[model samples]
Target: MRQPENLIEINYAANQSSVDVDELGMRDMQRRVFAEKDAQYLLVKAPPASGKSRALMFVALDKLFHQGINKIIIAVPERSIGASFASTALVQHGFFADWEIEDRNNLCTPGGDSGKVDAFLRFLEGDDTVLVCTHATLRFAMAKLPASAFDDTLVAIDEFHHVSADKDSSRLGQVVHEIMSGSSAHVVAMTGSYFRGDSVPVLMPEDEEKFTPVTFNYYDQLNGYKHLKSLGIGHHFYQGRYTDAIHEVFDPDLKTLIHIPSVNSSESTKDKIEEVNRILDLIGTFEGKDESGIMRLRTPDGRVLRVADLVDDSDLMARSNLLGYLGQVAAKDKDAVDVIIALGMAKEGFDWPFAEHALTVGHRSSLTEVIQIIGRVTRDAQGKPRAQFTNLIAEPAADADEVTTAVNTMLKAITASLLMEQVLAPNFNFKPKEPGEAPEPGTLAVKGLKAPPTDRVRQIIETDLNDLKATILQDPGFRRAAAGQLDAEVANKVLIPKILRERYPDLNSAEAESLRQHVVVDSVVKAGEVKEVGDKKFVMLAKKYVDLDKLDINLIDKVNPFQRAFEVLSKSVDPKTLRVVMDAIAETRIEVTAEEAVLMYPKLREFQRMEGRVPSIRSKDPHEKRLAEILLFLRRAKASQAKVNA
Candidate 1:
């Protein structure tokens, strides 16, 4: 078996005149072709709308006429996908211009006109022909082909994962492994889902480290957020049970694509009919008068049909009506809302940019399947940021917890994979950020935080404190204790004092008292209490006051002023004098009635605003401020407004 000469300076543009290099899909294909050239095998993994088929079609032409390498085989998991590719090559890419493509179904060759299997093998060994067939045919041909048959051939496998895991010995995997060991040939395996670490060994032999995995998880590489925003794609996420909450978020202006799995074979046909009626009912309510109100349905039978003109009781005639409606929609209003109600069949290969929302009701546990469903809604296109909304509908019987866990894990994996590729991939060619495009101020400030030796221990304590605060805040009885009204004795005896001691263990009784005095002042000032502490007082004049703002509130809150005099003297302060100041504040309890609670609500809002917290208040009716104001006014206002004049 002789090695074929490398076809250098191949004029891809000259051979394929119809191929548009500037198209997003074509440019993506070119990147894969170059990256894969150095490997013994290459895998192209992409999602539904990522244009995997179109990429393969262009690559096929470049390999055949442009590269002038005659013996090339294009294999697909299903006969339909293969036929579809062949049709596109002939009609769209002009591949059938000067050459005839032979299918495995009918062929007669030098092997004495044997079965279609034998004839296909002989055709591959013969001159200038491209073989397009299914995995079954490819396996059969490979098993019967002579040792010299694949010496210079290139095998392109579509939906390659099916071959690696499917029932029969995957013809593509088997042949590629055999050829790499015995002959010199390049194998390209393409699929939307390429589970790399697990599928690699089966797809390529263990010894063959010459495998390059190229993935275009559209959301990761395409910067879908920025791209979609540029195209005016508005993202709407409705977080609740799908069936109940999804309808509320539906925008009649945008076309919707719904993916719902059929229950079973018997129920699928019935479900399609019901789905058509529902779509018609919704579209009829549209205020605007346009042909855009059309509904197109893609059935399980692989036929894409429309829902217009179908009589309510028509049986098989409904299928034809669907087909007619689809034809009109595809031809005339291509960008119209395409409401697709499908089972899991459309998960991988379907791509419709006009679909702005996807509602999935399918019961699939595979991460790949879930990713594919989400991918359908994230496709990049020109008009209206293709499918900016995704709604997942769970079956009644589904375990909500298990489903959420699985979906979250899958999402994390997608996000991590995207980040890794962006930051680590060698040949990654994303544009460098412009000067103005850099992150906003303080964005990367935390990158300078040097970890302390006790960082982990400190984190645990902080987390515990946060959790405790949340629990306390949520308790109805605890919330009734307005700002200064919380029983300090109970707090001091319980976890609050313990946590404070843990955070400030060095504070002695007198120093702790000074800290508590400051906490009172800070809290009072925050509550709009503008009373001033006299400067001539001993406590206020301690060394003309060491900056009180720098004092630890936790340490201050636990002080016993009578225990030590120099504890205040350690800071050049007189304990007896400071006690008077502290006692004065203590005597003025400033009772925090429910009315005071209401008055203090605005301070909470102001604190939240200053701290950059999410504004939870949406309106004044349910607003915390309003609630506080109403409650306080009722408690403190004049009797005329408060009392009923019965």
Candidate 2:
């Protein structure tokens, strides 16, 4: 068959005119990306409807026609998707005639015909044609082709996550490693998101000396939805179960969109048919145009019908005729919304720019799949954006918790994809925002920003300590220690000595000697179960002589001094000596209120709270939870200080 002249003309026109390339949109960053010579691979990860494919299409076309490259290969997971991509690119560039696009199932080589294996080899041998196929096809092709065949070729792979290594088997991983190893081909790999550690090896194998680290960037536009809403061109979501709530929240002027998922199973098909018939009946009630310029109902139900069903004599044909008749009804009825029913055939490659709302009412496999379905409504038109409201009728049995996780995961994946493309691809760029399009002052730009540092590890330890302290201080027995038993020891051992030293540093030698004599009763140290001779120990005579009524003391002085001493001693003291001193200190007596008990002990507070009682210091696990309680008390004290300053 001779090549079509119109295809040739279109190709020639595309090469001569800059329309398609210009329409690719945004050039600044893409030009900067192309300038880098050291970059080994380009990774593009973009959200659905973010113009990733369009940008790539222009770049690929330019490189093929303008650059010296002889071959350009585009590979993806699905054959139909690949063909659709190639066809769109060719049609946009007017290059349809010069390309022989084929799926893996129907490929031909000059020598051996019909197998993708042979045909890919033929293309690799400087055949000067573009090859668009699946990743599996390329893998087989690579196995047959010699290493030299990769020279100067641009290889693009879409949906790259599918080729990632399975945890159980490394077969796909090894294949990717081999293909990328020592190849001179300029490669571009695209994916929504990559597993944390899985991406580096697949795209840039360590064994390959020429590999470069992957780069990323992101694009998120709030303007798209805003523009669509302003134009009043699309449907808005009405909460399916709470329609009144939706009405209360949203303006009545907005159009409503109802989304119904496919009921593809045999049993559900009957229900789906009935649902479509009911929607058709609803359309009959409108007198003229409703809030949405012209109301429309779209369902999926055409593939099951034959191409000749439009003119068939059977009753099935009459039902099949509903779509055309409905389209006519929409044209005739001034107030009517367009109603469409497609049988599993309307989703892929379908673009309805006017669609403003999408209501999802069924199960979905992945977040990416759901986004793709929703993306059908989010296209940009003449500076106006598409799609506003997305209403999902969540089934109670569909495991909403898991669905939420998957959706979040998918969104992250989309963000990661855009980031990769922005940072890595040389010929990719985003347009500068027009005046007044930037964020308002003081508003945070969270999307596409680098992550802030997390202090979670430190916080976890501190929180655990605080909790423990709160529990321990709530015991009645613990409260006794808090009251005043340690007060005498703390005053004699720590407070009086420190204060006396600080205030009267110039005391005469004779007075100091007299004071020391009065304070010390003996010089003796004891070993385990043994009385040692001539070892030094001090007993304060001031403890007996000083009048307790003359000195004012606070509870903090007693508790804090002992706590500090215990902390200091624990570090240097032998375990046996530490246990002896701890046992003696544990016998000390103090009094505490119920509030003070809970405030001082975290475990006690927790126990009280758990038992529906006020937190108390008198708890059984006083020692075990003392640390948390003390910490909590200290925190509250600090907070009080802050408030006083304020």
Q: Best candidate per lDDT, number?
A: 1
Model 1 misplacement above 4 A: 1-29, 35-39, 47-69, 83-122, 125-128, 143-148, 165-176, 196-208, 217-221, 224-227, 230-246, 262-337, 395-646
Instruction: Give the per-residue lDDT digits (tens) of candidate 2, residues 272-307.
Output: 545544444433332333332233322232111111
Tens digits of lDDT, candidate 1, 1-646: 1111211111111222122344333454445654455454666765554556666655555566655456777776654355445534334433333334644433222123236576566676577457766666777776776545776667777776565522254556656666667766667777665432221224432422355666654333344233243112211222333334445544455555555445452112345556545554544443232343244445444433432322233554554445344444542464444455554454555545445565554333343454555555555444644344333322211233343333232222222222222111112111112334444332211121222234332322222222222222222222212222233323332323333343344545443333323323222122121233563211221123322222333332333211111121112213442233233323333334443354445655675577575333232221343333334454565565557653
Q: List the candidate 2 regions with Cα displacement exceeding 4 Å.
A: 1-38, 57-70, 83-117, 139-152, 167-175, 191-350, 382-386, 394-646
Whole-model lDDT, candidate 2?
0.37
TM-score of 1: 0.46
Candidate 2 structure, TM-score to reference: 0.42
Q: What is the RMSD, in Å, between candidate 2 and the native fold over all Cα?
A: 25.5
lDDT of all predictions:
0.41, 0.37
How badly does each model clash, as a count of residue pairs?
Answer: 9, 58
